[model samples]
Target: MKRAFVPPADALIAFETAARHGSFTRAAEELHLTQGAISKQVRQLEDRLGVELFRRVRQRIVLTDAGRLYLHEIRGPLLDLTAATRQVMSYAGSEDVLNLAVLPTFGTRWLAPRLGDFQKRFPKAGLNISVRLQPFDFGAEPFDGAIHHGDPVWAGAIAEPLFDEEMIPVASKVFRDRHDIATPADLVKAPRLQLSTRPLAWRQWFDQAGVAADTAFQGSRFDQFGMMSEAAINHLGAALLPKFFVRHELAAGRLIRLFDISIAQRSAYYFVYPENRTLRPVVSTFRNWLLEEARTERTDPETMLPS
Candidate 1:
């Protein structure tokens, strides 16, 4: 087997900077090096690659075709390398940190409450949570795992089903009272809030409720459930939301269920991670703990209805 040829890090940095600035002098100023040093480093990189990386157009510099291609290819990897280096350096003696991506509303409402127990059990384990709305490439991102919604279709990942979701239409009590929403059929007359990702949510809800209304899909859209919930609370419109996400609001009477209809969500939440990816002890421990927590959560009533 033949070993891959590696270029000097300094030379690559110099080339990238010079290409970005379009001037060796500007690159040198930014890098805190002399212009001559910058030029020499770029020249060395070009020589090693056996390609002319830049062209002198009057006093300005332009990247050659090879240079542009290389820049495009290396930029992401270089950034990833820098980020990894910084993360490692910052946590020199710290405990293992598990980077988990989660849905914004779920992380805030459901997972956040249970995290304290995880911390108590694994005091030395650090859990870093980031909001991720959709499924993403596990290989590209630094996430150790993600809380994924929908089917277990993320390629190359093992999805451990957490729990199924049931959605219900909810609105501010003022809105419901003002609009005089007596049944699911009356919801069409009231404003209907929509989730940007779930464009067909309201349509599905209408179908389940067995109501046909022209205004089912006419309403403002929100990217996150948190924002949508706030909109519904503010009396902007009735929102079809997961039962778990609105538990507190429902319990507090801030948001009232408009009808006794609850639709089983087509998808469920899952704890997902790459199949072949190595897991740190902390990550593995959290996975096990999370499954147990989900199991211990009180079972939903056969019918979730307004009080």
Candidate 2:
């Protein structure tokens, strides 16, 4: 069997650093190694690869085409490795930490208010939070779990339902009056704002409103709900936003519901964790607490708890 043609870790590090700085001397300073040692490591790497990675231009160095490509490939992975290392280093002794990737707006509006109670319940459980706009492979990323929206179909994970979502059309009061958007059908011609993630949001609302909208899918698009909401407040266009997220805006009159109707979003909110990612007790603890919080937060005549 043939082994991978991977270069030594230190050699790759030296090469990347040198390419970034365009000087072995500067790379050595950053890496805490002598310039001579940096040069030696780079020479050994080039000899092993059988390619000249850099062009020596007087006291400066410039990457060759191959070197540029190699740098591009290795730089991202190297940064990921460094981040993973730092995340692990943050752990103390036998204590467990639950690292989570969360949607920014959800983390703010839905989860932030309840976090204090979670801390009171479990003081020792450490949690690390980072925002991610889109889903990624749970097996590949170093997160313990995520607060995900949509279907319970994360490839290698278990998605526990958090609650359902209903999107209501909203716009600034000024914009609504300007366009005289008194009916859902009026939105067919008015500029519509959309989330790229929910491309069919307007179509779903129009269908429920009993309005046949051919241009429903046509609109300015955004990636996050927060951006779309802000755009709506600034009178960019009418947008369908989660009722749960826009309560404050509606109360403050920053944004007003364009109509009384709302459409069920395509999928439900979920507390998703990789099935085999970790065996830490905090993972289950957090999930249990989160589900309970959801139940309490939406205590209507019909609870929104997972069935």
Candidate 3:
């Protein structure tokens, strides 16, 4: 295996601190080293990397273009390393931590609500969840598993089916009152909101509603479902959202169901983890628990529809 062009930790730290303060003297003070030692460390790093990290203008030190870019790249990894070290140091006993990356809305709306039950089932298994917009490298990121939405195919990972998307139309009561939304077809005429990720959502809903909406694809686009739901609440446009996302809003009457229309997306959500982690107790426990929850998930059809 080829070795990476990496410098010593002290050298990297010296460069980073110097870059932050724009002075070797300040960096030395922060690192509890002499100014000359700080200068030597930075010089060593620059020579090893074959890049000029700083250029002195008169008496003032300023980062070269390459220096600024390198600092930006390493700052995050450095912080992450420190955090990881601290996390390990804080471990009390045999308790294991399961790091997870999850779709933001899915985490907020679905997984979050059920986590209490997860804790009750396995009190010792600790979970650390971070919001993710899409699937990422399980090998690169420090994650035990992820909740994903797409096909059941991920490199170096096993995809376990969680649930399918159940979509419904929703609009603010004021927006509903303003528009003559008498039929499912009438929704095609009203202003609509779109989730940028799920471009086919509205079109699929219209097709299921037996409406020929050529412009179903046209609308105010949003990147997140949370934003789309809020836009609908404030009367931006009608939005097609998953039942999980708007359960509270629909119940609270903040957003009203437009009509008795629905659609199940072709793709479903999944619990994905690295292949080598299959036998790990935490991974298996969470996967089995989540799958059971998905199977039992149901929305009373009558309650979902307004009479």
Candidate 4:
């Protein structure tokens, strides 16, 4: 007969809390227990595990080498357990919820406007959105799917093509008028706004325009398109922005196209989900709806402006 291995849940919890806070008093306050009680629980856990988990340093406590390793190993599982419990509780009286990770700017500026139609189409299905700045492990996180930008190269997920992006040089009217950028060569003189992710954007743009500008590498770098657009609008510099993202600003005359030329991005946006995980009905419905929406947007004359 094989013996079952189970540690004391209460003691483990107490130890984890004390290790995290680095003080039994703080952990006890958080757990709503007496400091002595927390210390006793941790001592019991350490005895059972046959290892010292913490080092008493004056009035404070710090994790030992074994303690740090144990914390690292248990944190993910603890988070998963909590998320799973909350998910079950949430679904007790409601429809199935689909958790999706999306880019902050893209979700706000583009997807947010179309959510009403999605809700109308699937009134019974619930949607949850979280901002995801970069690629992450789908297995570790509780996301059903994600809206990802760049290449379809997520290690464990299936990447479905959303749309390709076309970027163009844009600047505020004030900046454009001040610089008098009549040609691509003249654009080299203006301050260039760079995106941190696309370090080679300016260099590529200059190459495509058949202009040599050593200053392409020098400029204010931003992590998000919204920030870069705002800077451009404030007359900070000229920015290379996706046409769709800046369509509203361009129409409102807040920004001006410095030239008619556009650079087609190599990588397109994608809808990604783990290949090993089963696709729920709600997630499938959302995927289908999103793809159709993208198709409609692509074919619409108003949405597809002339380059």
Candidate 3 per-residue lDDT, tens place, 1-307, comes to 3346667778889999999999999999999999999999988888888889999888678999999999999999789888888666644553777788998888999899999999998988878788886778887988888998989988899888877888889998899889877788888889999999889999999999889999999999999899999999999899999987898899898999988778888899988889876557887788889888988775345335654
Model 2, stretches more than 4 Å misplaced?
Answer: 1-11, 32-37, 40-52, 64-73, 130-137, 183-189, 210-215, 276-279, 300-307
Candidate 4 Cα lDDT to native: 0.86
Q: At residue 125, what lDDT does model 2 achieve?
A: 79
Show the lowest summed lDDT stretch of 10 residues, model 4: 298-307
Tens-digit lDDT string for candidate 2 (98-203) = 8899988889988887789988988887778999867789877778889998788888888888888878888898898899877777889999998998888888
- Candidate 1 Cα outliers beyond 4 Å, as residue runs: 1-4, 57-59, 99-101, 128-144, 152-158, 196-200, 203-218, 221-223, 247-256, 273-280, 296-307
Q: What's the TM-score of every candidate structure?
A: 0.76, 0.80, 0.82, 0.77
Clashes of each: 0, 0, 0, 0
* CA lDDT, candidate 4, residue 159: 97
Error of 1 at 101 (Å): 4.2
Pairs in steric clash, model 1: none
- Tens digit per residue, CA lDDT, model 4, 1-307: 3223456778878888888889999999999999999999999888877899999999989899999999998878778777778766766544788899999877987799999999898888887788998899998888999999999999899999888777889989899779887789988878989999888888989999999999988899998899999999999999999877898898888888888777878988899999998899999999999899878766655323223
Task: Please provide the root mean square deviation of candidate 1 (C-alpha atoms, Å).
Answer: 4.1
Q: Which stretches of candidate 3 lie over 4 Å from their true place?
A: 1-8, 24-59, 64-77, 86-94, 299-302
- Position 97, candidate 2: lDDT: 87
Query: What does candidate 3 score on TM?
Result: 0.82
Candidate 1 lDDT tens digits, 151-206: 98898899999887778899998998889888888888888899887888888889
lDDT score for residue 220 of model 2 = 91
Predictions in order: lDDT? 0.86, 0.85, 0.87, 0.86
lDDT sort, best first: 3, 4, 1, 2
